[model samples]
Target: MALRVTFVLPVFPRAPVGGFRVVYEHANRLTALGCQVTVVHERWREGWSRPLRHLREAARDHRHRRAPHRAIDWLPVDPRVRLLIVPALTPAHLPSGDVVVATHWKTATLLPYLTPAHGSPVHLVQGYETWNVPDPAPVHQALRLPFPKITVSTHLTRVLSDLGVHSGQITTVPNGLDRTTYRPPPTGAPRAGVAFLLSDSAAKDSRTALAALHQVRAHHPALLARAFGVAPRPRDLPPWIHYAQGLTGEDLAAQVYRPSAVFLCSSTTEGWGFPAAEAMACGTAVVSTRNGGVEDFCHHNQNALLVEVGNPTAMANAIRRLLDDEPLRTRLSTAGLATTATMDWQQSTAALLTALKAIS
Candidate 1:
């Protein structure tokens, strides 16, 4: 019999999100491999305990459940993949399968309540996602749940182990790059801009990256700085910084990553640093902070330059070095492309499947 797999997500995203993207990737691939795969989205998960918010969300969830197609139009989900939108993640809302995977700490809370027919429960730890809650203790406690855990990086594996999740229970399956869409621009294409992602989240440290760009501008007044995000361009961003709002897939590759000579990853922390990996796959040199997410694929001075977290001056200098030294930039870009080439989706999905099957 084909393995039956079910993935429970916190909510359906209206915009692009890295953690959610990973889950979709696996869902599509697992379905292709002949598994009976179903992805469940809770239409009414408020993630907190406010009565007013609950009432507001309850109304919004009703609207979403009726028009879920509008929310997922931006993503390219495989036709064979089964999508289920439920009011909540309780066992009563879930379908029985050989394995049920929790894609977030909040969703993991449902695993303990599920019976065997819902499949052996598994947790997919994409990040140390403590920022969402006021108390990180619950997040840590979820890691200790007696279920197999799949983490995106070795750093996350160590995090789980430190929290008493046995080493034997954690599997490290790095996120993969789709080379067909995220490859180097056609030979002789313009690779002359520096790029970074804009975000409202403090952990992403967009202020540090923006400050570094300003410093780089002091030396190279005509430097082209490009930024993109799902959110509208901030009014305060300098008029010179070209912002592309909400670009994805081929358009994101052709317009943002391919034109850039360098990509900046200034996040203080990440589970897998998706944009940096995508930029590298586009053969763009990278100057990143020592964010744990990039550690699995980035090597300082080998594939990319790494600096400390929250230091604008150091980030500025590193960007200057790449802009001034053409050969060094070329070397790093070449190396980055080579490094990211190994992160194949087939391999990552296979590893995830193996872990799920073992637990099942």
Candidate 2:
């Protein structure tokens, strides 16, 4: 019989963000293997009066797709694959399946309280969403008991270990890139000097980067700054910064690193520093704060220039270094490309499949 799996993510089918993309890729890959997946996630609620045209555009492409008659957008899910709409705040019940993976802390707790209980529940930890939840003790205790942990970074692996999870019980699953899409554009336009890793999130620290860039632009008059995946309304942003929201696949890969001389990520933490790796692959030097697992992939003053987190002066200085020094930028960029070779989604899926098989 085909393997049956259920993924409990807080939001699915609605949000078109990086996390959603990761989940989708893994789901599609697994489905190709005669496995079935049920995704339990939150519905998207659009507050603005944007284009229903785009919603219709998306729905037309997918057969099981449902467009919001009121204010929701649902994916055209496969019959074999199920999409369960669950409340954002409530804990979910794990349906019987060969595997049940709860993506965040809220859903992770559900595994411990299963109707008949479960085998080892797969808990995928990205960042401190585990730490930020109401009370982590239940999840922590479960991790020590029946939960086999799957993390995306050495940093997260270490953090979970600190929380009493056995090192052996946990395996590191790094993120990957689609090289064909994100590779450098053939025209090779003059590098877009100003770039951001993402500033809006708690880790990204948008205010600090914005203030520092305001200072940097005065010196480099022609400098143009672009925020990736931060501001939804691109036009509403201050005229100084350029806005490119929701660019993924090959286009996101190409624009973020390929032509940009320097890519910036101000986040003090990450499960894996995906933007840094992607940028490096595109031959773009990275200027990131000394936060999270960036060091795992980046060497300061070597392949990537690392600044102290929240230090606008240091961030501006690092960007200046890349700006004035082309050889250093080339060196970092080339090194970044070399780093991307080792990490691929195949590694993550293989490990995940192993864990899923064990669950049954």
Error of 2 at 340 (Å): 0.9
**TM-score winner among the candidates?**
1
Model 1, range 238-295, lDDT digits (tens) per residue? 9889999989888888888999898999999988899999999999999999988888
RMSD of candidate 2 to the truth, in angstroms, is 5.3
TM for every model, in the order presented, reads 0.95, 0.82
Candidate 2, residues 160-229: lDDT per residue as tens digits? 8888777877877766666655565554567867777554567668778877787788789888876677
Candidate 1: count the clashes: 0
Return the top candidate by lDDT: 1
Misplaced by over 4 Å in model 1 are: 45-70
- Tell me the whole-model lDDT of each prediction, alpha carbons only: 0.89, 0.68
